[model samples]
Target: MEKITSNQNSRVKDWKRMQTKKGRVKSGQYVIEGWHIVDEAIRHRQTIKELMVVDESYLGALPVDDTTQVFIITPEIAKHISSTETPQGVFAVLDTQDYHEKIPDELQGAWLLLDNIQDPGNIGTMVRTADAAGLDGIVFGKGSADIYNPKVVRSMQGSQFHMKLFTGDILDWMAAFQNAGIKTYGTELNDQAVSYDTVKPTSQFALVMGNEGNGVDPEILEKTDQNLYIPMKGEAESLNVAVATGILLFKFVK
Candidate 1:
């Protein structure tokens, strides 16, 4: 174990930089905060470069594996690196390179696609929901929220470790899924969109969710096998993207 009491320490400075997308990309790593997330990382055997704690009190609670480097730091340094309102005093630096999985040669099984979904919470919740629904893969289209954003990571609650996540031009992927004979459905609220109930759930499918305000891109909708919408039956004009995704995901799962 190592001790770091100063906020000016080089490692602490690097950890602080991880809060931004550019920094994460440059370093090829991201910070995972709190015990729950760290536990999940350990469970998944993620390539954790290091474990950092603000106090020695947490030492006993760390993973039994002696191979991981653990560092004790001052509370001030922890506060400086933590993104939450209240610091958890525990965190891990995980290599982003380790999480980059190869896209399957064939796109099959249930999948979820996000097109320019900007909200971090919505993105994270959707990922968690997809994992719960046993979706095979998730694709984040261009302009979507960064998967490693602190808020998104916290909301995912470590479910990202359990699912396959990819990033690319979702429109291109749609064509690939279609070529493989996978049914791709996009959510839209226009008259051309049919009620979700009209479509029967299948073992192999792809659901495309769009930006919160604009809905699915018109062009993408046109390319889908079916444009589907949930019957609101309420005064509210729309559903939060995450909630709507949950409903559609479970529908397909059932």
Candidate 2:
């Protein structure tokens, strides 16, 4: 393991560039921190270009074996590499293409769709919930948040590596999935929108979420096979996008 002490070091500079989306894309690499996510990457056989360890605490805790290319750095250096408030004591520059997930065989069981939902934290939490609820992959449209964002990865708690994730235009995917006899549903707050629990979802279906403020777009809503709403009895008009997603996802997931 080579020691990285200077912030001016080329590797340190590259890690800092990963703080932005363009940099991640330009280099085809992103930063993955913490033990859980890295372990998940190894378990999934994802390509890890470099592992940066900070100090003795992690040095004792992390399993040492086949770190083909590794680097050692101090906690201060780790902090410089981290994006979070409290540094996780380790960081890595991972090849994004190597970490992309394969489309699951069970694309029909329960699918979660995001239609232009752009919040990184919300996207991550929703993906985490969908994984926890045993839902199928999440399909992202053009305007949706990038799942490769560092914050999204942290918010997902390594669930990102476990679930099937697809990024591209959603219209074609939706059309194809529906054509295959899989029912597709979107959430809308309306008179015609029945309570989520009241509706009986098919074994194979897609649950669609929309933009945080505007809700589902009119075009996609028009195309969906069904529309449902989460019933709110309290004074609050609606739930936070993430919370609402959790409630609605758990219903059809089981």
Candidate 3:
């Protein structure tokens, strides 16, 4: 393995750039820290561009193949590349294209559609919950938190590797799902909305979750086959978006 001791090294500088959305797009790769996500990447045989470790201590714990390029970095270099306050001392540069998948011509099984959700933690939890509920995929629309964001990746706990993820216009995807005869449901608290429990659970459907502050976009809600709301019995004005998503998503599972 090669050793990277200086933060000024060209490779280290480039890897650090992946901490931002623009940098990730420019390089066509993103960095995932810690061992759990790396294990998922290795288990799924995703195209990992590089594996960086602070020392040899983690090598035995990692599932690295002959094709993986391994690097040993000083603690300073590891801190420089990491986004978290306490660095994991290990990271991986994974090709973003490896996570891309073509949207199916027809919507099958359960799908979660996120609309402009700005919170990275919320997005990650929704993905994790969807995966746990055995949902089919998640469509991250424009304005939503970047799926490759480090915080989002950490919160997702590698559940993303278990489901299909797509990025694009949410409205277009909704139209496609509707055309495929799958019901499109949006979560919103409004007079016209019905309790989420009122709707019968089906094997195939698309659930639209909106921004944390504004709820679903009015226009997108209009496009939904039906707008549903969770019956909150508490004094709180509203539930956290991630919490609401979990409550509603599991209710959809057969």
Say which candidate scores most in lDDT. 1
lDDT (tens digit, per residue) of candidate 3 on 26-97: 999989998778888888888878999998889998877788899999988988888888887979988876
Per-residue lDDT tens digits for candidate 1, residues 1-254, read 89998888899999999999989999989999999999899889887888999887887777736777899988888889998888889999988754334457777799999999999999999999999999988988888988899988998999888987888888788888989999999999889989998878788999999999998899899999999999989899999999999989888875
* Candidate 2 structure, TM-score to reference: 0.91
Task: Kindly report which residue stretches of model 1 are placed more than 4 angstroms away from their true locations once superposed.
Answer: 98-103
Local distance difference test scores for all models: 0.88, 0.78, 0.88
Ranking by TM-score: 1, 3, 2
In candidate 2, stretches whose alpha carbon ends up further than 4 angstroms from where it belongs are 64-67, 98-107
Worst 10-residue stretch by lDDT in candidate 2? 98-107
RMSD of each: 1.5, 2.4, 1.5
- In model 3, what lDDT does residue 186 have? 95
Between 1 and 2, whose lDDT is larger?
Answer: 1
